[model samples]
Each structure stands twice: as C-alpha cells, then as structure tokens.
Target: MKTTLKIAGALLAGWAGLAGAQPPAGDADIRHGRYLIQTSGCNDCHTAGYMQKNGQVPEAEWLTGDAMGWQGPWGTTYAANLRLLFQQVDEQAWLARARQPMRPPMPSPSLRAMSDADLKAIYRYVRSLGVKGSPAPAYVPPGGKVATPYFDFTPKNLPPMASQR
Candidate 1:
C-alpha cells in the first residue's frame, strides 16, 4: 500500500541521517580541555588581562601569555605562550615534557598528575586556539633582572624566636 511505502521511506531517511552523524572525537576532546583549563586556573597566568578583566577575555585572546613575571630564588620567569608552544611540538613531546619536573610557580606536580587523555585533550584544545604570540621570556638567573617588575624573592627579616630555658 502507499502508506507502507511512505513509512518505509521516512524510516530509511532517518536511519541514513543517523548513520552519518558521528561526532568527531577531536571536538569532544577540545570541549573537555576547555572545561579543564577553566576549572584548573590555566587562565590565571597564561592569559593576559585575565585577572584585570575578572576572566572575561575572549577565547581567541586566551593563553597568549602574560607580561607578568614570577620572581624567586630561581629568578624571573614568564608564562609561556601556550598556543605557540603546541605549534612547536607534537602531542607526544608535550606529554613527555609535562611528565618532567617544572620550575617554580608552575605547579608541575598538578600537571604531572593529569591523566594522559586529559593532557592530550588540553594539547588539542590549545592547538585549536591557533598560533598566537611569540615565545615568553627565557628564564633569568638569580643575579639577573627583567624589564618587568617581578615578585621579588628576597628573604624577609624576622624577629628572633623566644627560647625556653
């Protein structure tokens, strides 16, 4: 009957659409990475004006690196431009580096604790942000200085502790 043919045609069309509707894993990974980055405070150091704007910067401008430098016994260190970093290295290399111990203020232990899948997602997401900005300033030694004012790491004088006889 005509009704049976119509139903069959509609069902076949629906099935065809479903068959071709697989979501890309890369997109899913990027979405997950975005969530992870936001929750894990990646923007705090990596994104310029993030703190000034209260984290309202556009996605395109995110992870472009900041002018603020962290100063310590190790000297001044700048936040690296993550977008450009991915362009320089492959995912495996990134994972390898992430596994290694990082310098001060970088929270290397937290990064190292991330699952490989999560790190891959982050790598994919940063790459998706597209290449932007040059590399951050190189590490400065203890006696060296940087153009930007950094958090000085000089030891503070303290009052002497009272001793019990």
Candidate 2:
C-alpha cells in the first residue's frame, strides 16, 4: 500500500509538471493543509533555505519547496512544492497523494494517518502558499547559524533502511 502511494505521488507530480497548472481548491481545507505543514515540519525537507536552529517555517521560501539538506540513499529527495503541486488536484486526490509515504527520514505515515477532514484542511492551507520568488538559501550549519527555530534534525548523511514495525 505504501509503495503504491509513493508511485501514485510520483505519477501525480509528473502529471502536474506536464500540465503546468496550479489548480488549488479555494476552500477552508487550504487552511488545514497549512497547519499540518507548520506543525508537521514539512518545509524542513521540502523548502530550500538555511534551516534555522529550531523548526520554524522558512520565511523566505514559505512552501515553494527546495532541494537542500536532503541527503540520503534516495539521492537527495526533495520536498515537493506543495503550492505548485496541489494546484489542480481535488481535496481527496490531494490528501491521498500528500499522505503518500515519503522516503526514509520523512514521516509520511503520520500524514497517512490523518483523518480526511484534517487532511483536507492541511491540503487547503498548503495550496494557499502561492508561488513566490524567494530563491533557495545557501547552506548554514543545521544547528544555529541564526536564531534557533525549534526542531533541527540534520542526520549524518547515510543510507536509510526500511524501519521495522
């Protein structure tokens, strides 16, 4: 089931890329998605900026997604730009895809466990992070080059194995 979701997510992303449209649903669920992203620390992996000491949202990039500090056996998995990625999909589709298991180091299972309503809220919130111009930030030590954010977990670069239940 997890593998299927991963493949679905990849396929959805590919389809979105080909369509070149941002079709976010203009609803309250967007707010939920935003909350999920915030509390869940989605940007830590997706957005590209020098992660602050704590796990606060990267103000510069917001939810544009980025490719930094994402080193693993997956070969630098990037957090998908939720704003652009969820533009066109419906709430159910978005939730299903968003809940897809992310590669190791990402806790997609928790997201998968979210209730439909909760997931919809999160999806809506994420969709609202309209594409912006904050280019990626340079590398700063994951600890504290700036004011500490909240939760910093930059693991030593290594291959990830499937975690046993």
Candidate 3:
C-alpha cells in the first residue's frame, strides 16, 4: 500500500501540473483549511521568509515554496511549493499522495498520521491561496552537486549514545 501510494503520488504530482480552477467548497471547509495550515506550522518552511519574518508573511505568499535547502545524510531537499503542488493535485490525489514518505525535513510521519479531514483541510487552504512561482528545485542525491545555498548537516565528531545500564 505504501509503495502504491508513492507511485501514485509521483504520477499525479507530475500528471496534473495545472490547478488554477478550484473545486467548489463551503466557507466552513475553507476556514478549516486555513486554520489547519496556520496552526500546523506549514508556513515555517514552505513560505520563503516565513520564519525570518516571524510568521508575518502575507497570505498571498503562503506555500509558494522556498529556495532554502536542508542538506544532510539524505543530500538536499527543498521545501516543495505546496501552492503549486496542490494546484496539480485534486482532493483525491492529495488523500493518497499525502501518505507517501517525503525526504528529510518534510515530517512525512506527521502528514501520514493526519486524519482525512485534516489533510483535505490543508489541501483546501493551500489551493485557496492559488498557485504561484515555479516548482522547487530538484532533489540532490548524496555526493551530488548542489548549486543553491544549503544548511549543511554533515556530522562531525559526536558522542555515541549512552549504553543502557
């Protein structure tokens, strides 16, 4: 099931790259989506300058993806522009795609644990913001070249975990 969702997500993520039109949704649904997005810290990484600005970034710029890179044992991963990503995905696609694991810093486990309703709310909120900007830069595998600035996590000398007494 996991692999299936991953494959499906990959396909849908590429298949529908256009989502200017929004599905009809009630005010309550949109509100829930907005609430979920704000409270869940989605803007922390998804929106450029969000953290530096202390979450004061405008709603118009939310979920547009960021250029900042998180580099570590997994190489590098950029925050996906959810605004653009959700544009490509419909509600059903989001339900399945949301379950797939993403690279580091994505909190895939937290996303996977969310209820269907919560996921839908998140989707709705992002889509409501409308699509803007280009897709995030592609992933850079370990030992691969990276052009953008990144937060390096290459491990240095570190103490080992304490032995169980």
Candidate 4:
C-alpha cells in the first residue's frame, strides 16, 4: 500500500510538472522573425542611417531608421524606423509595400517574391528590434528639372566607390 501511494504521488507530481512545461508560442514567433529580418537586409531602407556621434557610427543605433535618404524624388523621405514602424505597420501594410512597384535604388524584387509567412516573420523581427526616431532627410527629387547636382537622377557610370565595390 505504501508503494502504491508513493507511485501515485510521483505520477501526480509528474503531471503537474508537465502542465508547467508547456512551451510558449509567442517566443518562437519572435525569435524566428528576428532571424529573417537580419538575413533580409531590411535595414538597407528602413533605417535612415546609423546615428553619428562624434563622427563615429554607433552599433546600437543601427536599424534605428536614420539611414533613409530624404533627397530623392520623394521629398523628406525618411526610412521609417522599422522597429517602431513594424508595430504600427501590420502584416497587411508590409504586404502592400512589398507588392508595390519598385522605386529606383530601392530593391524590392526579392522581397516581393517572399512567401507571406516570410514577410510576417520579417515584420515580427523588425518590431522586436525596438524603435528610435531618425532625422527626416530634406526632400530632393532626382533629376526632376531640379538643378541641384545632389538631386541629379541620372545613373552615374562611375563604379561605386572602393568600399561599395
């Protein structure tokens, strides 16, 4: 009888532990999303640029949405800080942006082809990164009869500087 009671108690304890052992679903999604965002290079557009402090780029400030160029045909274009934007921009918003026609210098070809699941994962990852407000770039449309050389829309034949090469 004592053995029986011991076995029964053990079983009860095991069941209680199992109940507590259930894995969390939210963590899995957030982790997966973070992996996809890093691989996708989402920061190339969404981050206005890295923040410069004392003329040096800080690693922590990366993906904070300061990388966006405001001088393109689109005026005051600031790459929405993906971290914050992801929270505000849902899966649908991301899907629409992905499907829209590609604008010059912004590469959407690969993103447009991504599966819906992938897009969601990417969005989730961006949101997890966290947001910091980036400076708004002044609007300068490319080559729109605008005389500013900085705004010239013409594709330069010169190879990108040594770093880009």
Q: Per-residue lDDT tens digits of candidate 2, residues 1-165?
A: 999999999988887797546554566566656667777777766665535545554555677766443443343344556667667687768867867776656687887887887877776676566666433343343332433232334457657767842
- Each model's TM-score, in the order given? 0.78, 0.54, 0.80, 0.55
Which residue window of length 10 is worst by lDDT in model 4? 144-153
Superposed on all Cα atoms, model 2 deviates from the true structure by an RMSD in Å of 14.0
Candidate models: Cα lDDT each: 0.86, 0.61, 0.87, 0.58
Clash number for every model?
0, 21, 0, 11
Candidate 1: where are CA atoms >4 Å away? 1-25, 153-165
Q: Comparing 3 and 4 by lDDT, which wins?
A: 3
| Model 2 residue 102 lDDT score | 65
Q: Could you give candidate 1's per-residue lDDT for residues 68-161 as a string of tens digits?
A: 8888877788889999888899888999999999877788999999999999899889989899987777888777858885666665785666
RMSD of each: 7.6, 14.0, 12.1, 9.8
Ranking by TM-score: 3, 1, 4, 2
Evaluated at residue 154, the lDDT of candidate 3 is 79
Specify the poorest-scoring 10-residue window by lDDT in model 1: 19-28
Looking at candidate 2, what is the lDDT of residue 145? 43
Model 3, 50-102: lDDT tens digits are: 99999999888888888889999999999999988898888989999989988
Over 14-119, each residue of candidate 4 has an lDDT whose tens digit, in order, gives 8778943533336677777767655666555554332223324443554565433435444333455566656677677887987787554555688788887777
**Order of candidate numbers by lDDT, starting with the best:** 3, 1, 2, 4
Query: Cα miss at 41, model 4 (Å)?
Result: 2.0
